[model samples]
Target: MTVNPGHTFARIAIVTVSDRASGGQYEDLSGPAVEQWLRRAVAQPCEFVRRIVPDGVESVRNALLQLCDKDDIDLVLTTGGTGPAPRDLTVEATHQVLTKELPGFGELMRRVSLEQVPTAILSRQTAGVRGRSLIINLPGKPASIGICLAAVFPAVPYCLELIGARKMAEALPDSGA
Candidate 1:
């Protein structure tokens, strides 16, 4: 909690839940997209830790627990495995670890995403609080990552503050990508 105490920098983790990416069938672009978006939007010194886990409830659960409960990460952004596909279990895995389910995050994300594509409703992206960390499930596509973050990240700092994370501000600029 509070980002290692006395440290102004935030330690964030980007977990990519993709079987293909984890198995080296394809490169992971979603995780880096998250890092890039946060770097520009947060405007604070941040240390990012990236993890690639295969799509599954167990893998996602394990990775989230390790980062939120053990790694001292302030924020955990999970990409991939958020769709309605059989293997998209990120939301369920995230639910298992959360102390509070913030459904509004998913609602807002889907609402905004619907403006871009109708299939947005198929995404199960959600957010929650586990310990002092904020975990948010994001769509796997690089473009959708930015879209969802823009809709929800404005509240991330406040949510983190309420959850006893390090006090910080997010300067979210217009994500004109």
Candidate 2:
């Protein structure tokens, strides 16, 4: 999973799960926001592969598998489909893809979000690891995506390391505090 040698950029997949976006009913703001955040935060070059999938377990699961297995991506950030609505199935899809569930990520995200809005408790956002790829589900709103990513991004490099992703240290600077 280490990015192949000689490559300066980390390969990342940004999956946006929204029926409307997938149907072309609206532009995907959250996915772009995730990419923007990565560009600013990583300090290293990143190859972001973006996907828009309808809100469904099968669609999300398929997209995730393809990104992690075929694309060999190091990280997958999924925005939208994380709420309690009838169509929100990002969590279920993530569970089907990841071998291990990282509950602490969700807990920390909700805790940080709770400070701003009491309804943050309703968010089902979570994170997990599929092979060497670390997948994190984020809220749909662009602003919320920024908030949640900032809260959890510092630990991403270490987590990817534990999952055996190579070349991460050079690509993702931790600036250990």
Quantify all predictions' global Cα lDDT against the true fold: 0.90, 0.86
Worst 10 residues of 1 by lDDT: 168-177
Q: What is the TM-score of each candidate against the true structure?
A: 0.94, 0.91
lDDT digits (tens) for residues 1-177 of candidate 1: 345665567778999999999999999999999988887888667888999999999999999999998888888999999888999999999999999999999999999999999999899989999999999999999999989999898899899889988766777465342
The alpha-carbon deviation from the true structure for residue 72 of candidate 2, after best TM-score superposition, in angstroms, is 0.5
Off-target runs (Cα >4 Å) in candidate 1 are: 1-3, 172-177
Q: What is the lDDT of candidate 2?
A: 0.86
Give the poorly placed runs of model 2, Cα more than 4 Å off.
1-8, 169-177
lDDT (10s digit) by residue, model 2, range 113-134: 9998999999998898888889
